[model samples]
Target: MANEAATRLEDVRANIEKACKPSRREPDDVTLIAVSKTHPAEKISPLLEAGHRVFGENRVQEAQQKWPALREAYPGVELHLIGQLQSNKAEDAVALFDCIHALDRVSLVKALGKAMDKAGKRVPCFIQVNIGQEEQKGGCAVSDLPSLIELARSADIPIAGLMCIPPFDIEPAPFFAYLAKLASDNGLEQLSMGMSGDYETAVMLGSTHVRVGTALFGERRKQEQ
Candidate 1:
């Protein structure tokens, strides 16, 4: 298991380098967030042992249930929340995540602000955009993005960048380009876009962060949460 984890991590890093070369971007420019959601600690530890420090989770509660021990065991592991957040769980989210990739609505902004104040810890956030405008997806509408960005800014939440999950099963390059443009227009630098299947395309388009899971962990275990 440990050898398997290290080999996968190495392969992913090589892919990142290959993606960066044509664009004249350095491999170091992209942060690979190994998405560990639904996978247990036993699965995650090998990657940790292989020296991967950044990981992503889909839910705050699940992360709360699993990450404390992992964090204690591996100092410097950075946890990012890649799922939608509820206002009521702001404090818990603030306590657990090092960064948030789905800060989309006004209430969450307010809640996180207050939570940060109370905890004396500020968590940086990525304003999630509904790049494909899918009704079932969770992200700020493109038209509403400016206001939401402004609102998060007003509340003094650290804006890490913009994040989006482009509509699945379609060519994703255009959506990724559009997201890069939006980030540029907003004066933001980090972009939390791409996943296992399309991260190379995302890297070519200037993604600063890629959330990859299946390629790194093989597949997620059944969710018990």
Candidate 2:
């Protein structure tokens, strides 16, 4: 298991390097977030042993249940919440995640602001934009982005940058480029775009963070009936 994890990590890093070459950016400029949602701690431990420090999870509850012990064993592990955030879970999300890539609404902005003040810890957040205008997606509408950014700033949430999940089965470059432009227009610096399949293209276009799951962990094991 450990060997497999190491091999996958190497592959991902190599791809990141290859992607960086054409873009004239260093591989170090991009942070690879191994998405560990649904995977158990045992499966994640090997990657930690392989020196992976950044990870992302989809749910606040699942992360709360699994991360405490793992964090104790592997200090300095950075956790990112890369899923849609419920406004009610703002406090827990602020408390658990070092960064959040799904800040999408005004209510959440207010909730996270209050949570941060109470916790005395400011978690960097990415404003998620519905880049594809998909009806089922969790990001804020493209037209609402400017207002959302302003609200987040007024509420004192550290706006790290922008994040998006382009509609699947389409060329993602344009969406990634759009997000990059949006961030620039808002005077933001970080971009949490890309995933296992599109990360290389994302890197070339200006992604500061890539959330990879299947590429790093392989197919997630089927749940027991």
Candidate 3:
């Protein structure tokens, strides 16, 4: 398992490097966040052993359960919250996560701002845009983006950049391009876009951070309700 983790990490790094070539972006300019959601700590240990210091988690509670010990052992592990964040989890998320990728709505922005103030920690945040305007997604509507960004800034949340999940079963380049434009218009630099499937394309399109899961950890086991 440890050997497999190291090999997969190497492959993903190589892919990122290859993807960066055409775009003229160096691999160091992009961060590969290994999404470790739903995987047990034991499963994650191998990747840490492989020297992957950045990881993403879907839930605060699950991260809280496993990460303290892991961080104790593997110092400098950067934890990012890459899932839909409930308003109520703001404080815990602020305290736990090094960065946030799902700052979608007004309520969440407000909550996270307050939480950061309370914790004296300025956690960087990516404003999520519902790029496809899909009904089932967690991001804010594209039209509502400017106001949310302004609000987060007013509330003192550190705006890292923009984030989005283009609709599944679609060519994601246009969506990624639009997100890059949005970030530019908003005067932000960092972009947290892409996942396991199309991250190579995402890197080519200017994603500063690619959240990868299945490629790094293998397919996740279905979670129970």
lDDT of 3 by residue, 1-225 (tens): 999999999999999999999989999999999998888899999999999999999999999999999999999999999999999999999989999999999999889989999998999999999999999998998889999999999999999999999999999999999999999998999999989999999999999999999999997666722
Supply candidate 2's per-residue lDDT for 130.
Answer: 93
Give the root-mean-square deviation of each candidate in angstroms. Answer: 1.3, 1.2, 1.1
**How should the candidates be ordered by TM-score, best one leading?**
2, 3, 1
Pairwise TM-score winner, candidates 1 and 2:
2
Model 1 misplaced stretches (Cα beyond 4 Å) = 221-225
Question: Could you tell me how far off, in angstroms, the CA of residue 108 lies in candidate 1 after the best superposition?
Answer: 0.9
Query: How does model 3 fare in lDDT?
Result: 0.94
Candidate 1: clashing pairs of residues: none
lDDT minimum window of 10 residues, candidate 1: 216-225
What would the per-residue lDDT of candidate 2 be over residues 65-182, giving only the tens digit for each residue? Answer: 9999999999999999999999999999998999999999888999999999999999999999999999999999989999999999998889999999999999999999999999
| TM-score of candidate 3 to 2 decimals | 0.98
Deviation from truth (RMSD, Å), model 3 = 1.1
Model 1, position 38: C-alpha lDDT score: 86
